[model samples]
Target chain A: MTMLEVLDVSGLVTFQDSGRRGWQSYGVPLSGPMDWFAHRAANSMLNNSTDAVVIEIGLGEAMFRAKRDCVLAVTGTGFEVVNYIWTFPLWTSFYVRAGWRVQVKKISGGNWAYLGVAGGFEAQSMLGSKSTYLRGGLGSAIRAGDILEAGKPARELAKLTARNFPVEKFMNYSQSPVIEVIAGPQQDRFTEEGVQTFYGSEYTLSKSFDRMGYRLELLPSPSSAKGIAQATSADLLSEGMTLGSIQVPDNGQPIVMMADSPATGGYPKIANVIRADLPLLAQCEAGVSKIQFREIMLEEAQENFQKLNKAFKTPKG
Target chain B: MLKPLGDSALLVQLGDEINPALNQRVHALNALLQNPIHGILETVPAYSTLLIHYDPLTLTFDQAAHWVRDKMTQLDDSFHRTPRRLEVPVRYGNASGPDLETVAVSKGISPADVIRIHSEREYTVYMMGFTPGFPYMGTLDERLIMPRIATPRTLVKAGTVAIAASQTGIYPLDSPGGWHLIGWTPLKLFDPTSETPFLFSPGDVVKFIPLESLESNSLLFDQ
Candidate 1:
């Protein structure tokens, strides 16, 4: 069996796919890649199934050795790749002979990266997914000494250097991002001034951000008596939450829920990140990423999401 | 109330409370939405709202909204279906329950009386959340109802039967909690390898069966 053995793991490295669907009603969060665009870009280059499992490495160094020859691709920002002593750039696919060790150096700008193989990595499936949900104990993250089996490799390995992706033009993780949002179910709960304050001020992502959610620090307003936005009511009955839903607790801080958030939350949601911009927000580095929210109509949000999908669609022969 | 949750999903607030009637309506709508729609990906039903995750490319926000509205008219509120009943055996008091005496003292009743009242009632599953397979069953006997502990424990053993406010549930995983621990069940509430991971689903019925007396000071963990 073709396998990739883990040599050194410095930060969070776990298997991910399109996430566990149809299981949220059972209280299971859809745990998938935080940066969907990066994950898909890697997989699309290989022509692998969109749901194919790939290793999602967080901001740190990781090393692996290939037991058999296979074609591979890596996508996302910040991290240098060295394959068999040959340095390579990001957002492109390459071929490796057996026993070639691949090393990913520590990331500097972005928080997440995706490493996709020709077919996909084999993993223990639970609830119709191979995604590793750390809290749920469904699948395990990649650890030192673990052997990961790879699926069937491609027959042709030519044009490795010729086929390249223009990732710099589309996805830039180094800049401060303004996230577009759609108004929420509890928009009426906030005062008009509170809504204005949310859009008017820029916020910083706090150190306590994780895959569950990102706790944001809202810059204080000069006019408001209180330092933060005030809500008509602090709590609501527990309601269903989606990925990128910005929930505001009584503390007035807006927390954007990610892939592994709780199924239901009691805090009132102020806004939801547009699906198209979710990948951009995902690349925002914790504590260093400054973010702002811009409100848009639902139709515009939907149209933007469609445009993103169209960009990734392969040309029809 | 229908609101756009994000670019890809819509949140339908069926009601504001956690009543059985409201939950039934949520389930009815959930079942109707299960049928094939052009772009409906998945639907998540919570205590009071149903969030539908769909593909924006195939269906617009208005089209999906109108589709749900048409489905809502066909639901029969009077229709009743018998739910699967699960009887869970629990060991009450002593080592199995650290807060049993505290709960009895607050209720102004004897420990045995507290056990009797808790075991006799048939609780209905209001929802499943907080953790995987953790069922939130509710409307305990008024006299037995008590507030959650002021300070939640950092680590409570899995399968520990806990009560907070009017709802009672079992901790499917060994995690921190604030509910009053009255006992523990030996049954596994969540098993990842099982064909059916959860022993109970929303709209199911549950009954607690008190096991025979055990030697004092003997913890359930010991067994």
Candidate 2:
């Protein structure tokens, strides 16, 4: 059996697929790659199934020992994959011989990185997905000494040609980028001034953030304009929350829900990052990056989303 | 009220009020839309809203909105199904409920009276969220209504039955919580290994049955 043995791993590295759907009604969140664009790109490089399981490493390092010759790809930033003596570039696939020690170094820029096998990795599927919901303890994180089996290759031979990927589309780590967002359903919960402050001001991601969501602090301003003001009735009947939904608690600070956010929440949501820009938001490393939100019409958001999907549709080398 | 939740999902809210009528409408729409529609993905039923996720490429927002409006007009309000009533055996004091005496003192009622009142009513499962298999059931007696703890405990044991405001819920997993703990059920609300991971859905009926002693209730906590 083709296997990759985990010699060492850092941070929260876990197996992930497209995520679990149809189970939200049972209170399960869609826990998958924070940067989906990177996840898909890595899978596409190896020609794995679009929803195949990959290792999602967050700001940490991982070392793997290949048991058999295999083609693999790594995407996202802040880390480099080293095979004993040779260093592999990001956003490209490479063939590793048996007994090669592949190690992902510590992330210096971005918070998330994805590593995908040619035929995907074998994982225990819970509720139709291999995605690990860490809070629920559904699937498990990769631990040292764990044997990760790679699926049988669909194609026997690997294509030696390494093609370039449009990094700007889905790859941005440690850069301060203006994220695009659509006004959330409960935008009215914020006053007009609050809305203006939200769109006009810059925010820094707090250190106390994880896969569930990011807590942001308002940047210092010259004017008396501070954080946004929340409505008196801040609590709502709990409703289903989507990824990128920015919820404002009584504290008035916005918390953008991530891939592992609760399926439903009671806080008032002021905005949601557009699907096209979620990758950009996900790449904004906590405690290292700052962000600003740019409001966009739903039509513009939809058009951008289509463009992103189209980029992935084109045949890769 | 219909609102777009990002590009992939649309949320149809019946009303924000926690009442049977609003929940029924949400449940009715969810029940009707359970079957797969062209390009439509999964549907999640919350307390008073049905969130529908769909592929934007196959179906535009306008098309999905129009389809939902059309579907709403044909909703069967009289449609009814017998809800499965789950009897949860609960231990009301000691380690099961750390705040039982505190809650009684706050309400100016005896601990035994608190248990009697809590166990007497059948709570409707309004929704499930916060964590996997955590059921948010509601409409507690106004007299027993109390605010959540000022500072939430870092870790609340799984199966802890807690109350706050007008709602009663059980923490399916061991999680941090702010609710006033009153009791705990021996039954597992969630089991990932089981075929049906969740013990209760949005519309299920749950009746808390107080136990004299949890030591004898070995069948409930088989784990």
Compared with the true structure, all predictions reach lDDT values of 0.81, 0.84
Clashing residue pairs in candidate 2 (N, C-alpha, C atoms within 3 angstroms): none
Native contacts recovered by candidate 1, as a share?
A: 0.78
Clashing pairs in 1: none
Best by DockQ: 2
**In model 2 chain B, which range of ten residues has the least summed lDDT?**
B214-223
Scored by lDDT, the top model is 2
In model 1, which runs have C-alpha deviations exceeding 4 angstroms? A84-86, A159-162, A172-174, A220-228, A315-317, B213-222
Q: Candidate 2 chain A — worst ten consecutive residues by lDDT sum? A: A156-165
lDDT string for model 1 (A1-317, tens) is: 55688999977899999899877777888899998888887877776778888899886778989988777788887677887668877788888778999998765777787888877888889988999898888898789999988776444555332346676656556548888999888878887888887888778778787788888887555733342365576458777888899988877788999989887788888889988788888877766777889999988988877776765687211
Q: Work out the iRMS of candidate 1.
A: 1.3
Cα miss at A137, model 2 (Å)? Answer: 1.1
Q: Model 1, chain B: what is the TM-score?
A: 0.89
Candidate 2: where are CA atoms >4 Å away?
Answer: A160-163, A169-174, A223-225, A314-317, B213-223
TM-score of each: 0.94, 0.95
- For model 2, residues B175-199, the per-residue Cα lDDT tens digits are 9999999998888889988998888
